[model samples]
Target: MSLSFELTQSIAIIGGGPGGYEAALAAAQLGAEVTLVERAGVGGAAVISDVVPSKSLIATADAAVAIAEATDLGVQFFARGGDGRPLRPQVAINLAAVNKRLLALAHQQSEDMRAALVAAGVRIIDGHGRLEGDHAVVVSTGPGGTDFDRIEADTLVVSVGASPRELPAARPDGERILTWTQLYDMRALPEHLIVVGSGVTGAEFAGAYMNLGAKVTLVSSRERVLPGEDPDAATVLEGVFTRGGMTVLSRSRAEKVERSGDGVTVTLADGRTVEGSHCLLAVGSIPNTRGIGLEEAGVQMTDSGHIRVNRVARTSVPNIYAAGDCTTFVPLASVASMQGRTAVFHALGDEVMPLDRLRITANIFTAPEIATVGWQEKDVTDGVADGIVHKLPLAVNARAKMMGVRDGFVKLIARRGSGTVIGGVIVAPRASELIYPIAIAVDRRLTVDQVSRVFAVYPSLTSSVADAARAMHNVGRVAEA
Candidate 1:
């Protein structure tokens, strides 16, 4: 379809995630008329079901972990049973109440985002939007698929996102078997929870459940929990998982899951079986690209149905674009939001920069959160790049020592000759927050010396970032220590 759209500055965005809403706001600010169509709610599944709810659930579990650690700080507790016997210092958890708070927070965030988009003068449509042709889209606003609304725009941004992947052998029943989305509805802690697929989601839930006093068994098909992350970071996290009383089944695969009278059973491909009170499937996600008329409208898509998009978010169709997990392999909301903004800028003929993923920062929300940015550690290890690595264990950091955190580290990688900060990994509590400066250094092409020269708050966890940067400036000085 050689559709040439005469730049009318009319932008239509499908899906109201960080990607869609951010583009709507950007196009509106650029003096374009913007329409946002979302069927579920604003902020998409990232806020409503997956990101917010899971993080909120983890927060609830984290509080329990903190209290559990307080015994060493001279904090004593007393509890007794009916027979005047000391009852195992009962730290109880109300799963129902925790889930209630999680949903409340997610819904609140969605509504807040919806309000923000409307306030920015972006017209919002509560419906599912799909491509009609080159420059047109059809929206079904009916409750029973009875009515439709047609919209035409000079430019369109697709940010429909993705859904949790469920295997046929272990489908989520929303009760005994749960996906990340349905876990929030669980009313009681599982006596033994089996987490299948030790990716980011599985590891996080396994760690959270352990902190919440549940017996968790993490089933990994890989050698380590987070195989794609920095090797050292993954190793430290696996150690943390092991010491926390969670079983790590390294290089193990689940063939199927079945629910019996009283519990669930996970059968491995090797015919080995493990029984648990509940099970969670965290294999991955499938892009919500089907039935959206993407191909019929001349937009190209991969075999698995993820929309093919460039760094500027442009699809094969001239005036159409895609962002977020629906278009890219990376599933971070921050990256999705940036891709959206880039799409709007490019479509509107404004100054735009193609997304440089090497400068992108991403985080995993585990107990000791793993955060990474810039060029990958593989570049240095493969001898593809000239760089030096500086690593500092958190056990030596004043704040980490004070907080009793002993199992994480901060590592920085910089160009050998120029000392330009290129990549970094941080595995610690609030690593998400700690990765920002390193991200900025990488984004702005700042040298390790330049990053180290910037003063950090005294005795702060963030100061460790600077310490690693300083070591990198001295070319692997900290690595030797």
Candidate 2:
């Protein structure tokens, strides 16, 4: 897509996370004078700590799980000692080595993003930056933040990202009681980990640790895991967690976390206590919009300190914009990147597509991952949308049985009269990858018949998606009739 106008304008961006980096690149490529100010190098927390390292750790956990599951597929290993007796070893995770590798990977990704930005003619500044009114950004640079640099631009974009939310009663001490960011510092896996929160982050870590051969206890304030996700998907995951030896405490609210000798104790609201070698807080995150001069610059903000930006990512102030976790939008890295580019395109007179929350795709990285896009089953049940839902179990799929996969299902939601695919849910291994076609169906507004017509590779997991769509086609027809 080409810009409609010449790049005579100057653009300044703060926070070099996915959103800031993308905005800088898009603006620079459009011939604008672009300057990006970042405090924690390029790629920000998403690369340096959060998404990259965490997902890499999950990949290692997946490998461990695969090794354990290999025996079910006729794969076995045996060792003999001096006495010639057969010995079998258990699957173990070298957590220190895994953490080192993932951290290195994160750092490498950060450097790669930095290099790309530098090569794109975007001025990069390593500093703490804030809005100096609407037209310029002031950055604290040099040793001890003793020096300052200012960049004046016609338009400004803020993508400062966010940090893990810390509860006052359950403060993370970074040792036995820790936040997700500090989890990688452990040299060995905890003997027992108590994860507070049943949200995506908490569930992901709890399942990952369990798969990596660690005892895990997940504390959820709600009755079920993944409170607002698809009910069937949540039930499947809860069963998986229980079968995998994960202790899930539902309807349990953690009141406080205290460091005991060599371990930690979590006190629940019901006067019950859970003791574990380590505790991880996955409650939520707070936008890094505090003391950033957003309010002074006439930018509207939410009660939680999140900047309020329109669909085009433009803030209340016409010349200023915000994206990523800092803005009041979906906080996924992909959404942030799109918001970044959209902000630049709209600001620079390029053709822009306003982001729609309904079309967003989200995936939970847990054992038997859960992925969803567009409308959900709850939406139809709650009368929020006119739709029909159909479900097909993966157990019925030829490939799933061959792969020794016993759980998971494909669910499709379509408009009642038109049969246009509106939403979908996938529960399976690598559901992250499997959900893409469903996302495409949602984005393109493809009818169930059109989706069913798309030939899927035989004896493959994706064929379940086609099957689900085919099942929904009849449902849609009956609804119309």
Candidate 3:
């Protein structure tokens, strides 16, 4: 790839999520005139409603979990007890204040993102944007609005993102029945909360509310929570959820949710009904692809309604690229941000690295957050990949022992003969942070020996990663027995 585009080439990015804003900055840095059109805010759902807000809420819950274990650290919570029963910790969260802070953090992040884009000379348009024809995008304030403008660009990037999917029978009143977005508006935690769907979103909220002192019931249609995650990782997470008092109704599908007097009634596919103070629908997301003039502009879409795009994020229509949740791939903010940058590089005729579907790292914000990168068990088991796996318990790590963390582990996968690190999974406190080195090892094609040689701080949880890598280096010798 060679740089060939003119400096004055105009690049218009529609949508203002992580993908859109990131593409705007990248394009501007390359001296392209960039115009970003957004309806809600510059940071889109990633900041305003979905990612940031949810993570903020999760932080509070994680703190509660940490404090509940303070007694183990010789920190006294109550006077030497009268009852024979041991004192278990408790937390009382003010949902009103918690949500208010979450919204504030979201707004601040949006403003920060907008400021960064503007500072980089990207024009920000506050309105809905749609393709006018082949080379122009029309921006309007909204439906039945007057203020509008048209932007003509040599290249267009669509990062419109996605919205929460809603079922007709289980409509949200933004009160008892809620979507993930409406969760921040809650004035009080649901006394007996029922979470539907056991994907990353569902598992995250279910674990979060349970930590925050809510009696949580997780309704899973699959055999386990986080069905798309690594199987062993999912098992560890399910064990943690169960131990934390969450009711996991695995293989029980929720067919409908309806308001029943002061609470909500969730009817299962088997005709079993579970009543709770509130129900949260995390059945997954629908791409924000409809009514955007995507098809009218000659952008081809898949049968499932996702935009058709190659690894480089290019749509069927020339000069147009799509990224983020709008495209058919794992819908994660990290991937969206990467695709956004890739689109900017490719569209500008600059030397570009195409997105590789395999070398992706994903993190779930559940307690003892699950993070994974690269090839999985099925891939190796099905003969699609040749690799060896080594799993090490976090309980063996000095830091984990000191922290009283008896659960979770770090697993490594490496190519069979070459011993090249191909994948890794971490299920521990702040596993998101611990998985980065493994991700880098997988992406850079580093060998198990190389990973084991990397410096790991003594008495730290991260050392478990290097320990797993070391075990993989000796896996062949161990396997022979």
Q: Best candidate, TM-score-wise?
A: 2
Q: lDDT of all the models against the reference?
A: 0.88, 0.94, 0.89
Pick the winner on lDDT between candidates 2 and 3: 2
RMSD of each: 3.5, 1.0, 2.7
* Clashing residue pairs found in predicted model 2: none
Q: Model 3: per-residue lDDT, tens digit, 1-481?
A: 3344545899999999999988999898888989999999989998999999999999999998888878788876753457765675456799999999999999999999999998999999999899877688899985675878999999999999998999878998999999999998788888999999999999999999999999999999999999988898899889999999999999999989999999999999999999999999999888998987889999999876799888888999889998899998668898899889989888887878888877998889998898888998778888888888888988889999899898899988888877888888899999999989998998899998998998999989999988888877766555465
Per-candidate clashes, comma-separated: 0, 0, 0
RMSD (CA, Å), candidate 2 to true, equals 1.0
TM for candidate 1 is 0.95
Model 1, 332-421: lDDT tens digits are 898889999999888877788888878889898888999999776688989987777778998889988888887889988888778888
Report the CA-based lDDT of candidate 3 relative to the real structure: 0.89
* Candidate with maximal lDDT: 2
TM-score of each: 0.95, 0.99, 0.95
Cα deviation of 271, candidate 2, in Å: 0.3
lDDT of 2: 0.94
In model 1, what are the clashing residue pairs, if there are any?
Answer: none
